[model samples]
Target: MSIVDRALNVKEQFLQELKELPYDTHSIKLFKDKYLGRKGLIADLFSSLKDETPQNRPNSGKVLNELRQFATREFEAKTVYIDNQNSKKNIGDHSLPEDPYLIGGIHPLTHTLNEINFIFTKLGFSTVYGPEVDTDFFNFEALNIPKHHPARDMQDTFYVKNGIVLRTHTSNTQIHTMLKNKPPIKIIAPGRVFRNEDISVRSYCLFHQVEGLYVDNNVSFSDLKGVLNYFAREMFGQSVKTRFRPSFFPFTEPSAEMDVSCIFCNQKGCNICKYEGWLEILGCGMVDPEVYKSVEYDYDKWSGYAFGMGIERIAMLKYGVKDIRLFYEGDVRFLGQFI
Candidate 1:
């Protein structure tokens, strides 16, 4: 049919539907949405105006406008009628107690991620993100983890079809960042990473991480220590003592794991600290020369450090949450306490 004929049909159908609409909210909403919503029949009629010939465009537009105005008035009148009908009916007990948990608070993991990002952003690191599902090249090969390297074993990854895998760490963001921007680069990649590990109280197949990177001339292990020490104090408490023990990672040379004294036992042993007086918090080291080679940067001219920490671990420590599973479980009672 022509635009005018279609508009006339729609107008008649709308009037018939509006008059037949029962005195109820549900029917009224359906009538309104069918004719008056953005993608409704009336709107579709308006959109079809471009197909009308130039000579007929003005007349077709006027007809559509009149139809819309009439439909809108009818819809509003029906809505008011339904509202009046609903108001006249009895609503249930007004004196009943309000729901105890009416409002929701931020998830502890999210709060912890924000806290880590805020601390580093204040320290001159801009927050950056990369894909959770990435190729082995960016996820591994670009960070200097070649295919036969034992570092591939460090993170049991979930491989998708055709050699793509869920990223093992947001450290993948480092490769993405350095490729896009030149140095004096400072960024923190806060995102989710996945592993092929078995689920347990302490371990899950998936978790969140904040991977930090800094690159420039003369950046050093000393600079890494100073920034991390300040972060440790800020995140845990002003009195928390931090120490670094030599460790290894494929992407960083001279790597170490950082630990803070157990706050719960007051420097005494506890299960949360694995009966040790210290709790390992994060891993860090000077960026490996191989990493610079992967990104085509001159290792001698540039120096930097990379660090990563799990969001769940930090939330567990900060909130005394023993099970890492609690963060993932949809337990509002457990989550509600954070408020």
Candidate 2:
């Protein structure tokens, strides 16, 4: 065949190869390799320039350029059409529900924290914050746990350096708030707390705590009970019962452990509650006069209540999560359930 005819035949074969091809990166790459790459039909056509007459060379060159332009336009058009189709497929049935991956949710810990905040916020408590690295004065002394106090042993605190330590409780924020801000101060301090402890199913070195403070004139033990009762009901269920047992904390006078009815069996008891028919949910009490003295609040004029609960513990009970360590471990299997 003539050089022009041979080039035409190759062009026909190239077009045929591309006729049923999908317009995507892979297909475009193959088209370039088979028809436009170095040694491809178009390159062969240019190599034949020497075989043509000088008069016919210019016309032949122009025709070859036109054919190349046509092929390019065809490829570009198909690419645009394919892209539009992909976009349409992605936007399919907007009225329909989204796919599982798109319907992500908050982490269980986050959800529990939100619920706790919501419950307290409704009771006129504002959120408060303080540094995680706290001085011994605020984290310990201000909370009435002296350096020699046995209660400090219970905490297993991690000392950052001389007198400075990673706060063992969000209660440190309470002391900071009390010193900086005055009474009628209803605030909740929610954040992570650290300890020097071994990892286990029920315990971890790092955990979260939500510490609450309510101070004002005539804030009584009854008021403390009322607030905690409302919180227990709001969190566990309206039917859940709450009670207080005599306990001890350095920061509170007549401290008590707050217990909620076993939610799993509605107070009938279960493995979760250790068959006790009650679960100790938190520690709370009438604020100690010593705590007031540390903050320089007049004990006679101002009285209040303070409470603290472990976020991990609450979340575990609420969601039936068996392992406290799961909250710290970023296992996709555990987290995917919440998502």
Candidate 3:
């Protein structure tokens, strides 16, 4: 065959061999050495060109190089395609299914918070948020829990300056909401709160809370019970029961602690509920008249209720987590369980 025809024939044969290659690495390496390697067809062409006339030698060499370049690219692409095909086949049904046990899920706290927000949103409450680092005015005085109040000391707040503090509760956002918006206001503020407490199974320096507020003319105690009852049923189960125990707080005059029947033992009593057959889930009450006055709302013309709950506490009870510290420690083993 003429030199160009011979080179073209070799390239076509090389590509044909590539198409039939076994989808394996060893077979691929053998093909690579036989055609594209240094001692292969293109290398022999260099030696053969010396025998041609000077003019033909250059053309012959050009065609031979072109053939080698095309073949090299084609073979490289084929190698990748074959490797991928083999990889998929090896990972196919003949292979064992991966253990579903190895997979994980969303963090318990995140799951609980999402459920809480979902319920509130369905009830027409808008979600609002504010800064974690706040001034004493918004965190305390604005909420009617001013300096020197026993309630201020109850939170064990982390101070940043003389009066600046890491927010002790999501309640700080309530003041901002009131100041910026007029009544007919309904909002849920969910966020991280900080304290100065010693870390332990039950308490931590930081946690999360979701505080809710609803204000309008004619809001009353019955409205608070109705909303919380709906929340308990939706969060725990349709049959879950809730009760309001009279409580005291600086910001809410008719403050009460909300409790749901112990879900762990289904109100049969459990250690998680301190064996009392009840789990205190949140705090709720009517907003104090002083809180309204701070925002210049006419308390005599409007009345409302506010509620607050710790996210970590809800997460712990839902998942049976014994230690609050487990939620804060950045342990991969602990996190992977949720991921």
TM-scores for all predictions: 0.71, 0.73, 0.70
Q: For residue 244, what is the lDDT in candidate 1?
A: 98
Model 1 quality (TM-score): 0.71
**Top-down lDDT ranking:** 1, 3, 2
Backbone clash count, each prediction separately: 0, 0, 1
lDDT of each: 0.90, 0.87, 0.88
Residue by residue across 1-339, what tens digits does model 1's lDDT show? 988899899988988887788886677677778889888998998899998899999999998898889888878887788787778785657798666678788988889998898899899999988999999899989888888998787779899978799998999999999998889899999999999999999999999999999999999899999999999999999999999999999889999999999988877898888888899989999999999998889998999999999999998998898899999887998988887
Q: Top model by lDDT, which number?
A: 1
* Model 2 Cα lDDT, one tens digit per residue, 1-339: 566777688778868876777756887788877767678778788888788999988888877787677777876777788788888887878788777796667888898999999999999999988899989999999888987988877878899898999999999899889888888799999999999999989889888999999999998999889889999989988999888899999999889999988889987768988889998889999889999999899999999999999999999989889989788778777888887
Backbone clashes in candidate 2 total 0
Question: Which ranges of candidate 1 are over 4 A from the true structure?
Answer: 1-101
Model 1: lDDT of residue 268: 81
| Residue 301 shift from truth in candidate 2, angstroms | 0.8
Off by over 4 Å in 3: 1-105, 336-339
Encode model 3's per-residue lDDT on 1-339: one tens digit a residue: 667877877887887888788876788888888887789876777778878888798889888888888988898799788878878887767577677777667777888899999999999999999999999999999888877888876778788998899999999999999899898999999999999999899998889999999999899999999999998898888988898899998899899999999999987877788789999999999999999988999989999999999999888877788998888777778878666
lDDT of 1: 0.90
Q: Which ten contiguous residues of candidate 2 have the minimum total lDDT?
A: 1-10
